[model samples]
Target: MNERATLITNEIVEAIRGVLRKNNVTFGEYRAGFMHLVKTQQAGEIPLLTDVFFNSTIVDIENESRKGTRADLQGPYFVPDAPVITDGQIAVEDEHKDKPVMVLRGKVTDLEGNPVAGAEIDIWHSTPDGRYSGIEKHGNMDKKFYRGRVMTSEDGSYEARSITPVPYQIPNKGPTGHLLENIMGGHSWRPAHVHYWVKAPGLRDVINQAYFEGDEWIGNDSCNGGLDEMVIPEVIENGERIMEVDFKLEPAVAKSLQAAE
Candidate 1:
């Protein structure tokens, strides 16, 4: 028997039933809701809807016993195989010369505080104008900008330069976007953040987004996935916006040991 599936499915069914009952939802309303879900699925927006509404809870539950950095959803904008950055610059193209520059420096370490050299950190984020490069839907340009991979040096330190992120609205041109904006009575703005994905051999890879401190949408993320530990301040000293944040990875051996236990 598929015990876990059965248990989860039953629980979900019960939860939906409770909502229906509590709201005294009529058959017409229920049918309309069902059709909306169908439209969302047909429009390939189920993932967006799920991420906007529920992925944060899943991340939180899975991270309850984790000892390293917290994990987060990769979102829908991730593009793999970004070019490696050697000049410490994340923004390419000449147009970004006028954009505000942001410097991100960090160290990747193990749970025991030992530095993990040569860890590959992949990063991508939306532009200050609320567009992500290489995403056609974000901007007409499909060139890679503000996206690259950097490796932690011998001391596990890494740095990259890019433009600061600004709050971006979820693309509301599709069915899912319409549902979130029109029917959900919710805003589609996400706080400014930088997306990070780090990996090292024999260590579990972690993907997380770091939000800027004092963003008005911090507590009201459209996805509800923001964490206090994942927030960083806008460090402006000498007229430069440089910030520092570190990540730690627990050894894979530890996860295996825990499973055995």
Candidate 2:
């Protein structure tokens, strides 16, 4: 193996050994656990270990705040070019309006507090039932529901109407569920949140999620994507849930082109 691979393998082996020692696991116990994992895989009831490990790594990187809005994982459900929306448009369909209605409004600004007018903010989120739009589970193939793109106006402000997202468990029938629930002894739920992909000229493109405050999973996100800085408090305005959040973008670093001699 190459140097990096060898180092990583050794590190993982050491970590496993440490856990085994700490847990007082004997050879027989270790063998039994290993066999159980193998059997689970053979039965096709679990996801690949690589995917679980990758997701765990993502969880380990949460709450890293540098400047501006701290970034979070994009999860795995972003679709590009959702129908463009004007200010104050509703993104959710009437059929899915069982949950409390919410209005999300925000301003896109630069680090220096200057408005980034005309910035594109692509937003999407899970249904109140925790299923995403345009996915097979939702039976939405052609039309995009609960997802759209809106541009900031001249003052860098935008708004949209939708249902408030709620916490829901991740897919629990697979190996990832097994790892989180059985082995890790942790809940497999993600906190209520909305995803945003913001882009503007001369600014760094940001793909992040805004979480809801007071969510049960906010302190225990399955994917480790929750951070206090990303949390938005909810208010009741005219019988609708209202969340106002502002985004600050950092100027994009210019890349130099190769000069022709």
Candidate with top lDDT is 1
Cα TM-score per model: 0.92, 0.80
Q: Tell me the tens digit of each residue's lDDT in model 1 across 1-261.
A: 978889999999999999999999999999999898998898888888888888888888878857899898788788888888999988655776777778889999999989999999999988768888778776655546878999999999999988788898886778777877777877888888889999999887888999888899998888887778888877885666776879999866466666853
True-vs-predicted CA distance for residue 112, candidate 2, Å: 0.7
Candidate 2, clashing residue pairs? 46-175, 47-175
- Candidate 1: residue 54 lDDT (0-100): 87
Q: How much is 70 displaced in model 2, in angstroms?
A: 0.8
Lowest lDDT block of 10, candidate 2: 252-261
Candidate 2: stretches off by over 4 Å:
1-9, 21-28, 31-65, 137-143, 253-261
Candidate 1 has which clashing residue pairs, if any? none
Backbone collision tally, model 2: 2
Candidate 2 Cα lDDT to native:
0.76
TM-score of 2: 0.80
